[model samples]
Target: MNDHLVILIRSFSAFFILMIIGRILGKQTLSNMNFHEFVTAVILGAMAANFAFNEKIEVIHLLIALSVFTITSYVLAKLFLKFRSFKMWTEGTPTVLIEGGLILEDNLKKNNMTLDSLNQQLREKDIFNVEEVEYALLEINGKLSAQKKKELQAVTLKDLQLNAGNAPQFPIELVIDGQLLHGNLDSNHISESWMNSQLKARGKKLEDVFYAVKGSNGQLYVDDYKDNIQHPIDME
Candidate 1:
């Protein structure tokens, strides 16, 4: 066999083996992997690569290493789920960065995060001013969770004491990419005739509409394939 063909076969075989192992281990390894999980994934990848390219290393040895790493990760996940203390130890606890509009500088230093970084994170959450925050926590996943001060928060229906009717339903997509979503219409208690009527009212045909949605407010929103620019051109 050609050297290139042998390499290709080895690489393809390693890929399939990894896929099978991934399926057995489940999605825990794929998403939101914590510190231990991340380390395990790195080590597994390195071992798999060695097995794929290195002719001196036996495939069975690499397989055993991969199996051990995966099984250990799976067991750790199970332990985290069952024991809260273990979970906290492995994943770490949420650090209180801001409390009562005051920044916890010590905690920030402990977490190796700078004040500028915290401010940047705050801005990402649409919070421009740190004084407007009542509480802010640095979650284990390195994400910031903030609570705005009562005065800084947006006005809610409850605050106004308005008698708002039943909760509005989510907008139901009727058509997407000129394809009618029959299942959505059926689930939303809408009929094909009513949908057609809506299109007719807008001087649009079903096939001509690029997208259509029935909003929670009983409004039919439609978009066409072509842009209808109505702005006046400035020739100057």
Candidate 2:
């Protein structure tokens, strides 16, 4: 078989197989995926991509591999639904961060959560006062669910009758996946030379950066592709 022809055939096959697999798997959108679902989707995509491009691997082998993994994932999902303990084990239970307007220091420390991070999440929800939050939970999906104090629930910005001096500014991404976002940089009046100097100071090149964003505080937060963490958490 011609190599190009073989590649084209494999690509088509992979595409159709993925469509079938997705239908079998049901609705799991990228926006609201849990950790296990994210892992499963990534692995399946990698496998399919490898199968499509790597001609050394036989077509039948790829089919068998996909079938095995698909069945395994399906079985595990069914198990997760059937047993409460199993579901909790696979997908962690919600963590309580605040109770009765008081921060739970012990719970925060155990989850490796900082006050700054908690405050940031709260700020995103337009909540400025921790005392106003009667209860706050860190959901399993990494979303913050907070309830305001009964007295504060009806209070509005109009009632305060105070000038909130400055509005919060969202962070702008200057670089993502080693690609420079030209518009973001231009809007911020950030020069490439300055960005290069910043990267050099950190002993990193542009290609080494996974994400680089200018924060509301006017600080350039650069995260590199290599996460040199001594202990990385993995549920599975």
RMSD of each predicted structure: 15.0, 18.4
- Name the top lDDT candidate: 1
Q: Highest TM-score among the candidates is held by which one?
A: 1
RMSD of 2: 18.4
Candidate 2 local lDDT, 1-236, one digit each (tens): 89899889888888899888877876643455676777778888998899888988887888888888888777777876556467778889788798767899999998889999999999998999788887888987788998776556675776366344433234677887687878768986889888889889988999999889877445689988789998999653
Clashing residue pairs in candidate 2 (N, C-alpha, C atoms within 3 angstroms): none
User: Clash number for every model?
Assistant: 0, 0
Cα lDDT of model 1 by residue, 1-236, tens digit: 88778778888988898888777777756766678877887887887798778877887888888889988988988887656568878789788898778899999999999999999999999989899988889987788999887666687776466434534334678987677888888977899999998899889898898889977456789999876778858553
- Pairs that collide in candidate 1 are none
CA lDDT of 55 in candidate 1? 77
Cα lDDT of candidate 2 equals 0.80
lDDT, model 1: 0.82
**Candidate 1, after superposition: displacement of residue 106 in Å?**
0.7
lDDT value, residue 7 of candidate 1 = 78
Weakest lDDT window of 10 consecutive positions for candidate 1: 162-171
